[model samples]
Target: MHALATITLALAAVVAAQKVGNLVPEQHPQLSWQKCRISSNGTTSCSTIDAEVVLDAEWRWLRNANSISNCYTGNQWDVAQCNTTASCTSTCALEGADAQSYRDGYGITTTGGNTLSQKFVTHAAFSFNVNSRVFLLEPGETNRYQTFVLMGSELAFDVELSSVECAINSALYFVAMEPDGGMARYPTNEAGASVVTQFGEDNVKQFFIQDGKRIETPAASYPGFPDTSGLSLDYCKSLPTNFQDAEYFAQVGGYARHNEALRRPMILTMSISNDHWANNLWLDSTFPPDRAGLPGAERGPCPSWGNGPAPQEVERYYPNAKVAWSNIRFGPIGTTV
Candidate 1:
């Protein structure tokens, strides 16, 4: 995996209300990570850093700052508290996520020292938490997020996805983001990365799985491309994914666009979400199911009814779906391995 040495992406999102962030004694969950240095002679040294995880503002409780009434409830804004964005921003405040809140309210937790886990579906205090997005905070700082610059580096981490199954996505990636969480540009965005996005078409899509089987091999690999473990503009340009929204990543310069962005510091984000948009066929199934006969259309091993179940079906069938990422180590290209 390519090492990400930066973190910064602004996710423009549409929430039930535009409220001020996590105000009530914000408590971020603790997670351990590290930065390593590799000498020319192959000497390696690593220093573990203490970090914290903050829940995205959307999942935090939004209540009237002066009272017990919730500003937003049951998928709707309590108009009495917030009839407009200004009203909502002024009247409601997003609450903090303690470790308990992370686990009970959002189904997120840090255990075994560094591993962070996200559950696809869980019963929360108000409703079901269908998905979650969390961010990493800088060490020794309460709210400032950590950043990395990953241009000539390699980022390595162990992922537990035996339970992640189909239609559900658990992700970890970097984006050029504001260290202060965009609070300066958008005051109402008291929370950082309220809605995050980056210039990439595929994240975990390179991993081809088919019911415990990885079908794609080097016979169809890009010229001079030794393996599927890595990607290049050549591979993206020539590979036939039959993406449901086949924009041809190479046409837009693909990772090239992102590589330029990486020149600056960027923020890291982790999340687990169900794709209601296209039933997540883009990840593990033949995205445009009709194009299954296409050479590279088949993506993963799970049975595909257009690539597994839709969001609703996944919620019902795999209520316990979860993913754990840990032992994250970053440094020179080969040092991490």
Candidate 2:
């Protein structure tokens, strides 16, 4: 089975990077952020903020079949759907402390681009690597908060070689969350103004468009976007050569501090569509629970874009999930914009 899914993706990336580097954002602190908003005719302006994203990491089930690890279920997966299990560990520790205070208010950093180094290595050489769960947006974004959503992780396993010397590890599964709602702020404005100012220059750059790839934008001059006519990004390394372009990349730093928060900015006007692939953002389960966008027996219904299980297992393994849908923007100066 592909050498046991590359030894379970190298023992789940050395036990989830030594247990998330011995977790210490004050001993288990999810992201956080409270309020934001502003709009003015006084100087070509726009503002908005509401950063709140959290994840109390402890959900393990990358894969298990060779023998079955007793049906794993690390639970807690509520990006705001709040399924259960104590309301998904209290909405993943209050949206992981509001995505770590929207990445420390704005001075975010994960040490620049082409990421994958903590020892996993990847400048683009291509030896092999995987085990990425996404969430990386560009710095200090005002109001328009710019249509957010950066949740990743699911290469499951690859990185080969278990011979000549020694290399084969895989086993990652962790979960935890149980703090209830107590710090949910963000709702002011009657004179108590502070709608997060600072405009244009927060650019924006993030990636992870895999399948058939194209993600272009090395731009000579172009970054328009009013209703779309310029800005091109969905993958472009060079005339379609079977690009999966997104091979795990992270650049997100802790948001709005309290110990790293994030999630304030939802004006929703961001465009980049292959038509919301498989329902919307790779949903899986073989959707039969009422079927939606892509579950074709002959392409009848038309609405299984985000939850899967049909359309012949998403067209027999994502037959180009709508041309591997993509559009991720911001990138001209300083690489990842």
Candidate 3:
């Protein structure tokens, strides 16, 4: 009887451990991050800085439909806007290849302070894309905002999509500078004028963990554009409405196996979230060629151009396309976000 009781206790302890391992991450109450910044002289001289961005605080409107008007006027923000929208016309009009149309009627507002939320317009004809933006943490600087991730550094955040159906092509990624100090822009001279090519395949790496599976690849390797084509239903279904942890580590040394120059300094641009009408816009144009042949090679819920659903149909089929990110933290490899 004594031996049987001891065996039962051991089994109970194993079951408890398994339960603990299966538990998901609890939401963090506060978000914080730190990084090292190079001085304006562009030398090795640097300073370690710490900063906080209110993930749960009010987020000011960074850009809106009216903001796109600047695209036609050749303004400072025009270049960035045009690149992001993949405007086909020289004047950056709303109609053309890979063009995105905007209606001021749609906008996102923070709900409950801690969660950033947006409601998609029910009107069939109204569609638009906006990136709720945030700048990199560069404390105490006027003209220069320079920060870089070294080997063994990690970037992490918790995010969730409202609904996979509504968010056709929603994504989160990091944009950074090349070793030459030049920032990559969209619409490269490639055949499809792919955005990933313009960003320089080596300059950007996206890491994602979905339903117990981990996927890490360069943005350019994603065939056409960074849409939802390659993602699995289990992955999409798993996205939480509240925050869930995601991360990317700066493995420059790993990349240096291909290009040695990456061992030098490179500046980090801001992280971003954008919504789109097509879930797999750029799945056909992957780098290294192998990614194009992966399973679900021709799979995604979004319709083709002429076959797309009407406005009302779209509203009914894909409702509430938004994603919220919080608990953004970055530091050494073991740092938690």
Candidate 4:
């Protein structure tokens, strides 16, 4: 095994809301990240950052490598001048342009429907303030597909990139994961059919961290945001009648499930307001659970009138930091709001 040193692009360490108690600095602070400072201009956020990613692949030429002058000048002539200078018409190291010459390549999708693309490793300081109120890729509780693999736990929720853009950037610098990691996954079956309707009571306890030591304040209580002290990551059946109209919300009794096939841990942040008329912040003690089996399996019989079986309470992360929620949504993927 040999180690090749390469530097092609500038990098980042997004540090916008890096406050005191909201972060777990002692165990997982900035190590080797590219600096990224992204904010808003008006209603839209046009932020940019230079990031370097490390490529951990075998011998192959990159598209960006073509711009390198030294490697080309030295190797091109020797490749073209094989024997006859009069017949030398190429600038590469081999004959028969298409047969033995190198060409750029892309990753192939496997039989399992998963594509093996660029792999991004996050080992640096990173931060961002997205345009939406909830930092979710989708509007409601629904299932979506993500290409990254997430590992580690708690203060070390590290994310490893495996996409084309990530691979190209990985060739440049070392990148670390943000505290919450990347995308959330919805659990699936053998045929890839969504199991959203499969929630029940028996499995509600499996998704939560009840007795574990408190990591930090719930990310929902980040200063100006509402309080979310007792909500748990487990399955929730109902919502307060007063909290009925929060924009971009999951309605009570709505069928939702997570796409767990990606195997990435998600840090879902939510904001609750007391004023039923407008969005006001209020912390709820109970939260939803991961529905894994037949839809409505654990929910028992349906309610006669309102919605859901009944109202209940659960534990959740409080004291919001970068108040963000999982990318999971309600309804099918690609469906419009």
The numbered model that scores best in TM-score is 1
Stretches of candidate 3 off by over 4 Å are 1-134, 140-146, 164-167, 178-279, 282-319
Q: TM-score per candidate, in order? A: 0.77, 0.21, 0.38, 0.18
Question: lDDT per residue, candidate 2, 64-131, as tens digits?
Answer: 22222222232323233344444332222211112232133211112212211111111223222111
In angstroms, give how far residue 308 of model 3 lies from its true place: 6.4
Residue lDDT tens for model 4, 119-157: 111111321111111111111112121112222111111
Question: Which sections of candidate 4 miss by over 4 Å?
Answer: 1-242, 246-256, 259-337
Candidate 1 has an lDDT of 0.65
Model 1, runs deviating above 4 Å? 1-24, 40-42, 66-83, 124-127, 187-219, 222-229, 239-256, 306-308
Winner of 2 and 3 under TM-score: 3
Off by over 4 Å in 2: 1-23, 26-132, 137-328, 331-337
Q: Estimate every model's Cα lDDT from 0 to 1.
A: 0.65, 0.21, 0.31, 0.19
Q: What's the CA RMSD for each of the models?
A: 6.8, 18.8, 21.5, 24.0
Per-candidate clashes, comma-separated? 24, 84, 6, 72
**Model 3: lDDT of residue 236:** 31
Alpha-carbon lDDT of model 3: 0.31
lDDT of 1 by residue, 208-321 (tens): 334545444233443443254345554555454422346566567677675776567777778998886778787877756777766666777656774457678888988899
Best by lDDT: 1
